[model samples]
Target: MANDPIQQFEISKILPLEALGTDISFTNSSLFMVLTVGVSAAFLIMTTSGRGLIPSRLQSISEMCYEFVADLLRSSAGSEGMKFFPLVFSLFVFILMANLFGMFPYFFTVTSHIIVTAALALLVIGLVLVYGFWKNGFGFLKLFVPSGVPAVLIPLIVLIEVMSFISRPISLSVRLFANVLAGHITLKVFAGFIPMLSKLGFVGVVGALLPLGFTVALTALEFLVAFLQAYVFAILTCMYLNDAIHPSH
Candidate 1:
């Protein structure tokens, strides 16, 4: 058993599969990913399956999710971005589930890994770039060019804009990874102290209660962070999608 907080993230294979020349094995991370997807799918399906005139509690919750995403898209990206509701909604649910799933005991927090988040960030940036170019062609170049800059400063402005654009994926990925990693590590460290203090008799037991209390508080905060990170990711994705729609900005 590893006492190190970071080492706990390792995902070992639960059930190995060897087929068709490819090592399509299933690891803990893979299992969690499947679980997240399944949970999300079942949630949406069950909530929406009975769409009645008098909505049930589950139906209301589903409708709330739909309208929530709809409002976000409409407000952030406007009418043109409505077509991308599915993509944005899916991103929200997936990231939300990923973050929540990682909070479970004995589960690997995939979102805690930069590679997983970075890949998702890259996908968003890639979509923005591809759509921007496809929609506006050379006009998309305007994103890097400001209208009010002096001729001598045009090069510098464009360079800065380009750098910021390039850094989007890194920033997006790091934000989620750092939050989840820090929260989990904090929880683990506090948990470790509880057992260590258990041997100290009454005084130590009393002292351990403080950390236990803090850990409980922090757990609630982590849940908020999970949803907040998901919303931030989706919002920033929408903002970037806005650039695709109106590249002149």
Candidate 2:
């Protein structure tokens, strides 16, 4: 059971709650979320708390994180998008940590779950919609209709645009969820082969190296996927926000 990677995703209540339906649940996924947030927060805060005239090693790491996210936001969303720094930064760090945390011996990866990813995706999408409407009011509807479309083409164009707009959250959620889920599953299948391979003695050891090496290589690849998945999520969010800020024809 300890060797089973999927067991990491199991949910268990740490403190039973009859009130809000959840009381200190210590689910694997929940634990991972808490761990990711706690670790990420500590990493950032401790790194930057020094505020040195000349940054020390930790300070340099902190500055790099800031510059990395700042550059990402500046390039993807521009200066007007600067106000969303906290949200964007949090999203990237949280997802990155979640993906990385699962690589540990007994930690769950919340990002692997569709529900968790969907909730985050919806949160971003919801915010984009709220901000868009607040900023543009009914003019937001203009996003669905091309500025120069002939009357005959307006309906078809608006229909397609509306469908695409509605699908944003689904696409965003699935991309992260699917990637992490598949990667973890593949890791598990390879790891499971060890027991069977071990029973064969000498040849078993030799055969076992196949899965062992694959796991090692895949683990490295997973790290890259972790970063890429986070980047993809953030960039897509920025693109959606851009559309909201300036609805295209």
Candidate 3:
């Protein structure tokens, strides 16, 4: 059990409870998610509460994150997309915090689960669908119809476009889920090797150092991946919202 890499991802009940014959027990994942939200909110609030002209480190970080998402929204969806800044920023920070929190020992990675990622993906897609229709009416269907296409190929292109649009949530959720799940599994497997190698003779001690160094490097890389994944998720959301704002193409 000690060497089982997959065991770390297991969700065990911390406080069991039942409601209407359904299990609503709190688990490690729930705990970490709550922690993620609380910590993220507190950090932003506390850092910016002073409203200083000359920014401190934490204040700079808050301002940078604000500008980053704002610029990303503008670039992807144009000035009109700034209206959705709150939604996009919230998701970016939440996912970023969740991913970073999971990097710590014994912490549950909420984004690693398909259920969580899928829920988030569905929320974005659902909003896109609702707003697309509400804002553009039946004209939203034009999103699947490309301009200047050959008459004969229009039907085929529409079918492909429809399929691609429907697959967005699946692809988005799976991308994050797979990356976090695989990364943690790989890190755990390599980590398991260090103790095993150290138990051997002199050669084993030297061998252990190799895995230790590699593990450290991988951890750093994972941090980069964590941030990138969050950015990708947020940017993709902006692009999808763009389709809602301008469905002509």
Candidate 4:
């Protein structure tokens, strides 16, 4: 029924197509992803297309978002990290737009999927590795070795650092996927309660009010979470980039 929480997460093919023995069909997730990127791009362009000494509301919102991510990168990775503004800004805008789009009824949440989140996290880590090696050469190996450790503990510390480094993508992906998945599921559950409670006449209708209120409150909170998750992801990306830019401490 409409109350089934997991039903919201179902990925259905929109235009079934296969190539090279693989299911390369277009899907609802793909649709929303396109929509997310398109809408986000348009919003930025429309808002900032015309410059003004005194900004309009839309321009102000766009500038705020730009500064927010820029400040975050500058603070976390230093002014040297400004070179990565395009990457970090793109990630933040994509995630924030995808999440907000998912908030609408009948929309698919892309970031709620582990595969999508994992891909994004892997991209960040992969870039870090490539840049770190390219910029620092073999000296990037110092990232796993602290300067002050004793010879005896160096081996053990290096082992721990290696493990932690390997786990970055896993942790980053799971953090985003889990939060989005759990929040949506919880929202659905509470929302489902309203219809069920309303089936029992007067008392049922009154009880349904509670769930309705909760649903509204949860929806509001989810909006905040959507922005926050994007912010956290961007900031974390900056920190990882910092490691790449200055690998040795």
Q: Which candidate is the best by lDDT?
A: 3
For model 4, residues 129-239, the per-residue Cα lDDT tens digits are 999999999999999998899999999999999999999999988988888998899999999999899999999999999999999999999999998888889999999
Query: lDDT of each prediction vs. the true structure?
Result: 0.89, 0.84, 0.95, 0.93
> 110-154 in candidate 3: lDDT tens per residue?
999999999999999999999999999999999999999999999
| Highest-TM-score candidate | 3
Off by over 4 Å in 1: 17-23
C-alpha-based local distance difference test score of model 1: 0.89
**What would the TM-score be for candidate 1 when compared with the true structure?**
0.95
| Residue range 1-249, candidate 1, lDDT tens digits | 455777767768788888988776798888888999998899889878877889899888888988998899889899999888899999989999999988888778879888889989999999999999999999999999978779999999999999999999999999988999999999888877888897899999999998899889988999999999999999999999999998886
- Report the C-alpha displacement of residue 183, candidate 1, in angstroms: 1.0
Q: For candidate 4, which ten residues in a row score worst on lDDT? A: 47-56
The clash numbers for all candidates, in the given order, read: 0, 0, 0, 0
| lDDT assessment of candidate 2 | 0.84
Question: Looking at candidate 3, what is the lDDT of residue 85?
Answer: 98
Each candidate structure's TM-score, on Cα atoms with residue i matched to residue i, is: 0.95, 0.92, 0.97, 0.96
TM-score, prediction 4: 0.96
TM-score winner between 1 and 4, please give it: 4
Ranking by lDDT: 3, 4, 1, 2
**What does the lDDT read for residue 29 in candidate 1?**
81
- At residue 54, give the lDDT of candidate 1: 91
